[model samples]
Target: MPRPFVIDCALSFAVAVSTVLTSVIAGGQAEQSPPDWVGYLLLTVAAAFLVARRRFPPLVMVLTMLVSLLYFGLGFGTGAFTVAPALAVYTAITAKHRIAGSAGAAGYLAVVLLADRVGGQRDVSEGNVWMVIWILVIVVVGEVSRGRAEHLRAVAEQAARAELTRELEAQRRADQERLRIARELHDVLAHNISVISIQAGVAEHLMHRDPDKAHAAVATIRQVTKDVLVELRSILDVLRRVDEAGEIFPPSGVEGIERLAGRAAAGGIAVDLDVRGRASEVPADVGLVAYRVVQESLTNVIRHSRAAHASVVVNVDDTEVLVRVRDDGRGVPGDDVRAGNGIAGMTERVEAMSGTITAAPADGRGFVVEARLPLRRPEP
Candidate 1:
């Protein structure tokens, strides 16, 4: 059986035993003792009904009150015999049946007062006063218990809601982190693959017609492949053990744009890199964003733009870094400038650092990609 049911059974049994003891003791004190069976039967029924008090508190109170009245009607005095019914009153009140509990208490008090008057026993007024005091005590105790139970219930509900909120926030942050990692992998692999593709095509075209040019192209491919593998290893290391605090890849910034331009030149696209303002003073994340914007822009130029030349401009101030990548190639339509994964990836990185990016065709010429990234970190 459940623990609460065991406790209720014990309480009910105690009440029944106490009622019988009271009746026996009181009968011995009476001038002429009445038969014991009627009192015992009435108190026993009242006490037994209390076992189900939590399930039907008001019903138990009513049944106990009726049994108590019958006991009094049979000339049995109200001594500890009232204990069982009093407990029923408390049970009803604690179950939040206030109106029924109050009414039951009032009716019980009236019955005790009437019983006293009808008996014409000595000091009847004193007995009635004592009855009222006891009833008030029971009501106050029941109300206090109800208040405490309600307070505990409300506290439990608030705790459950707080836990759910914390779990949802954790899941949301994990999703964002996963997306950031995927974007990094895409950017790294895409640039390397584009370089390898251009180099491979050059080596293949010159392999027979010009042996020296083909050998150089093959050398370029080897260097680019080695560099790509190093970067890929760094990315994989970070993925394998994310909690480690060491640097995953070599630090990349706007200064690396020179090496990028050289690689683009080797791929047969002449790149002009221009710097203005204090580029070295830019924050690491801002500088990295500037580098990525230029890298992706040039990759696009080599793959799509048939024109021979592209220009990269990097300007920095005390507060922000500004970047522009323009190509003198067959420009895309304005409507076709909408975000694909590459453009969307750039936009996500910039906006995450509180920056802005715009990509569109240049006036009467090739395509342009411009970005402005804040030097200082943004507030959460």
Candidate 2:
């Protein structure tokens, strides 16, 4: 059986035994007829009904009250016999059956008060006063228990909602971190690898006709390869991978745009890099993203554009930093050219920092990429 069933059974036994014994003792003190089997049966029924109090609290309270009233009205016993009924009414009140419990308690009090006024004295007796006190106690204690139960349930629900909010926040941060890492890898590999591809093509073409030029192209390939390794190591460092003896390479932000232009110029494309404002005034993150916007634009030029010249310009003001990279190549490709991931990555970065970017063909000329990065991010 359930633990509650066992407890209720024990409670019923205690009340039954106590009520019968007390009623017998009280009956002897009275001038009424001695206690009979009917009196014992009435007390027993009231106590037994308590066993199902939790399942049908209001019904149990009514049944217990009716039997107790019958027993008292017959002069079988009164004092301690009211205990079982009080307990039943308490269970009903705590179960939130406020109307039924109040009605039952009032009915019991009314009958007892009426009997007292009619039977012996017009003045209230000590027993009637005690009955009123018992009902007051049951209502007070039952209300307290119900209030405490409601408080605990509210606390539990609040805790669950807080946990769910924390989980969703954690998931959102994890997703943003993953996207940041992917963009980093794409920028580092695509730019340097495009350089190596161009140098390799130069070396392959000049190998038989001009050995010295071929040697220079080979040298450029070696230098570009070394840059790739250093950039890769920088990325690995962020993911907690460290080389015991490798040289650390700090990411060169806007300062490296000059070198970027140099690298492209060496690949036979005339390039110009201009800075119109103090780039250092902005946050490191803003500068880094500006650098990437330039880097990715140049890589696209080296890989796709058939023209020979490109220009990169960066302007910083108190509010925002602007980056513009234009190539004098075959203007933006036709409809047949499939889209590239670089533009999407750039857009994500700019928007994440509350910035804007545009990449399209210049009016009647080559392709142009422009991005405006804010110095200070806004509060969410």
Candidate 3:
């Protein structure tokens, strides 16, 4: 298909045509002239088969070889017809037909010799044999070069596809991270900001009439903002890489319940925590999810309930971790299930860890949230 191959094939055809015409012209002038035109015609057809060598090599090569043998038997110019078998030799090698190619070459030589012997032509020389061998060598080398080029092309295409796949995967991961950040900002930061805004307005109104209580309200706003900063940092740290050397913080776990309880207490929601478990053995990711579920559940209670006190009970066993949060306040109606983002977020976190959550009010009292998470840890 290349310019050089096209040129070469064209030239070979022209030569074969010239040989046929010359043999015909000579035979017309004299009866002893070799009747090699038939051989030249067969050789020309065989050489042209190279055009489809890449697409159907085995079939083309076989047909061409058969024509070349017939040409040789008819005593068409041995020299020109020799190109046919030689070209077949090249195609065979190119098609990775080592045994077939070699065997064909040997069979061709045997046929040429046997034909000459059977025809009683004892004057045939060995120069033709040398010429055919040289041609075969050149064709074999050309086929080798072509095979190498094809291999290199395949490798380049494979590498390009792999690179494209990697880039797409990376882009998909970035999009997912952005979605996660948006969800966290909407659920956690937005709720905290709303609470801070309402409390700040109350403090401003009470400043002249109730100075001590106003001061206490300002302190509550400051503490809430501080807690917001810590959580915001946790989210941002994933992007900022504050700790270049390693992970920034040990993952928040069941042990973190105490701090979470203290924060709720500071915000005027008395929270009592009773932890019973081998909290240290939980998977970091699962522990984080469990802790967030409790934190978010308590946040909802503080924002929605007029309950004076909330209790969190953590029970960890060999197979699973169970969390229960109950409050003593106005209860939801049995038939009226009020669904909110807080409950949805807790459910999402628990489900992500192969866990389940149940939300309902305690008998004749307040709301209760419970989650059960399976225990599965990766080896360090």
C-alpha lDDT values of all predictions: 0.82, 0.84, 0.71
Clashing pairs in 2: none
Model with the higher TM-score, candidate 2 or 3: 2
lDDT of 3 by residue, 1-380 (tens): 46856765675576467646655665555423466545555766766775655556566667766877776565554345565456656666666776677677767777666776787765654644675576667566856766797799899999999999999999999986786677566555754665576567668998999988888878878977887776677788768966545334335688877877776675567888998969988888778777877777777766777778999999889999999999897866656544666677677777767788988988878999899998974343
Q: Write the per-residue lDDT of candidate 2 for residues 40-102, one digit (tens) a residue.
A: 888899999989999999989989988888887887644476888899888988898977887
The alpha-carbon lDDT assigned to residue 170 of candidate 2 equals 96
RMSD (Å) of each candidate, 1 decimal: 3.3, 3.1, 6.2
Give the worst 10-residue stretch by lDDT in candidate 2: 331-340
Q: If scored against the real structure, what TM-score would every candidate get?
A: 0.85, 0.87, 0.66
Find the candidate with the highest lDDT and give its number: 2
Error of 3 at 339 (Å): 5.7
lDDT of 3 at 16: 61
TM-score, candidate 3, is 0.66
Model 1: per-residue Cα lDDT over 1-380, one tens digit each: 56877888889898888888777876777553453787788888888988898889999999988988888777776456567778888989999998889899998988778777777766657656876888888988999998999999999999999999999999998899898778777777777678778989988999999989989988988988887787777777777875556435556687777777877887888889899898777778777788888878888888877868999999888878889999999987766676457888889889988999999888878999999999887677
| Candidate 3 displacement at residue 215 in angstroms | 2.3
Q: How far is candidate 1 from the true structure (C-alpha RMSD, Å)?
A: 3.3
Model 3 local distance difference test score: 0.71
